[model samples]
Target: MASMNDHPGERAAADPVKLIGVRETPLSVDEVFRAVGDDAAGGTVLFVGTVRDHDGGSSVDRLGYSCHPSAEAELRRVAEKVAANHPVRALAAVHRVGDLEIGDLAVVVAVSCPHRAEAFAACRALIDDLKREVPIWKHQTFSDGTEEWVGAC
Candidate 1:
């Protein structure tokens, strides 16, 4: 009998994390979801962060996101944590910088696991940790002719 570590199936289950930075452009939700698609994995969870048109009753016209160099590094670290904590088959995360129109995707996260519960838990944890630990900031441009810089709130 093959040990867990020596088993081919177990070795193939490991998936490395991916992080990417890009200029603000149209994001394909399908692409992100496909990155985590695995035949052995029964569950896949995708999270998309969008630029809402309104914030706290104020109409938001657009948003500008900026990140410290350490931000992308931190995001990679978060993805690594998810892979270590769960049976993650594949993981990918990308964040857009520069100007973005309302309803644009700011970030996309996808995770696949052998079970639905683990997939949901890991997906939620990945996004929650990214929001709290990543150093990305957003400048909200309001329709009232004002702008405010805020953390990934």
Candidate 2:
């Protein structure tokens, strides 16, 4: 655990969050996988979320993602929490917003740790927290012309 009196820069150096971002452009799995690369890490986990073809028995024609201004900060906070709870050597996460079609990548996250179990747990925590805590919203347009928005808040 980091001491409360520890300098922010020093703490960041000791436990680095390698990459964090919310982008309107397309996301890359290779980029995220590479970002969390660490020489000392024995295990790495990568997760990718994609826009699927259907939802709730309805065919999805397209999907759009939107977010509040504080979304990136919230994502960083989630990453920090995961890092604090695990032996994370490196971590990275990126989410895509704006218009998207079926099969488009929606999110990518990766974590590296000293062991495979730690890495898997940390990566799962990162994604779960981000989805629960962040203000990113998803809008789905069904083939029948119905639209819906989904988010925590």
Note each model's CA RMSD in angstroms: 2.9, 4.7
Tens digits of lDDT, candidate 2, 1-153: 768975443232375698999999999999999998887788899999999999999999999999999999999999998998888889999999999989999999999987799889989999999999989999999999999889945
Residues 1-153, candidate 1: write the lDDT tens digits: 667665343333544574444446677788888777777777888999998999989999888898887877888888898789877878878888888888889889888877788889989998898888888898998999998988855
Segments of candidate 2 deviating more than 4 angstroms: 1-13
Cα RMSD for predicted model 1: 2.9
Which candidate leads the pack in lDDT?
Answer: 2
TM-score of 1: 0.85
Model 2 scores worst on lDDT over the 10 consecutive residues at 6-15
- Candidate 2 clashing pairs? none
Q: Which residue pairs overlap in candidate 1's backbone?
A: none
